[model samples]
Target: MPKKERKRLQVVISDEQDALLTRTAYELSSPERLISKSEVVRLAIEKIARELGEGEHLEEYRAILETEEVGEEEA
Candidate 1:
């Protein structure tokens, strides 16, 4: 017999963040098609873990921040 799937849990978001999430979901296709916000947050945590694992090297993070700043300035 096949293994049974686990049940899903519910999460609550603030009204402002919820609106942004919905807008993002629509832009990325449909909310149903996109992964859950929890999953997205988990992936972000994994990325941070990988970055920190590279000890004494923060250049990557610095570059990312610089790029964001530049984009904001342009905007």
Candidate 2:
């Protein structure tokens, strides 16, 4: 089997976002298996895409986009 090639992405988040990511990964981890922050991010990206494709959470997604725009303007 051939190795998979993956592109890298750089994301900048606030302290609160970092804490939330760390906490979520910790909560999802267990003695048998540990969840990494990278896994959490990939899962979140897949979930968001699935939900958007299904026409679900549009309002919440819009709100997030608006908030992100404001945050970027502030930065």
Candidate 3:
């Protein structure tokens, strides 16, 4: 399989958010006692995406996605 390029997302967070993620990851680390910080971020992103996908904005969001694709192609 060809390796896919991953886009990097840079976010500025407050100490509270940082602390929550660190604590959450520590508790959720399964099988392996060690936890990847990225896993905490992914869990949050997945939850948000799932909720938004089922919201009234879902159709509107689809329209935005289509427009974004055209914009990307033009870029």
RMSD list, candidates in order: 8.5, 1.2, 9.4
TM-score of each: 0.40, 0.89, 0.61
Instruction: Please report the candidate that would top lDDT against the real structure.
Output: 2
The global C-alpha lDDT for each of the candidates, from Candidate 1 onward, is 0.67, 0.95, 0.80
Give the per-residue lDDT of model 3 (tens digit) for 18-73: 89989999888877576877888988788769979678467777897698678667
Q: What is the number of backbone collisions in each predicted candidate, taken in the order shown?
A: 0, 0, 0
Q: Taking the tens digit of each residue's C-alpha lDDT, what string does model 1 give over 3-63?
A: 9985676755457767776665456556557766555555655878777887634787789
lDDT, ranked from best to worst = 2, 3, 1
Task: Kindly provide the TM-score of model 2 when superposed on the true structure, using C-alpha atoms.
Answer: 0.89
Candidate 2: global Cα-lDDT?
A: 0.95
Give the least accurate 10-residue stretch of model 3, judged by summed lDDT.
53-62
Error of 3 at 75 (Å): 35
Worst 10 residues of 2 by lDDT: 6-15
Summing lDDT over every window of 10 consecutive residues in candidate 1, give the lowest-scoring window: 23-32
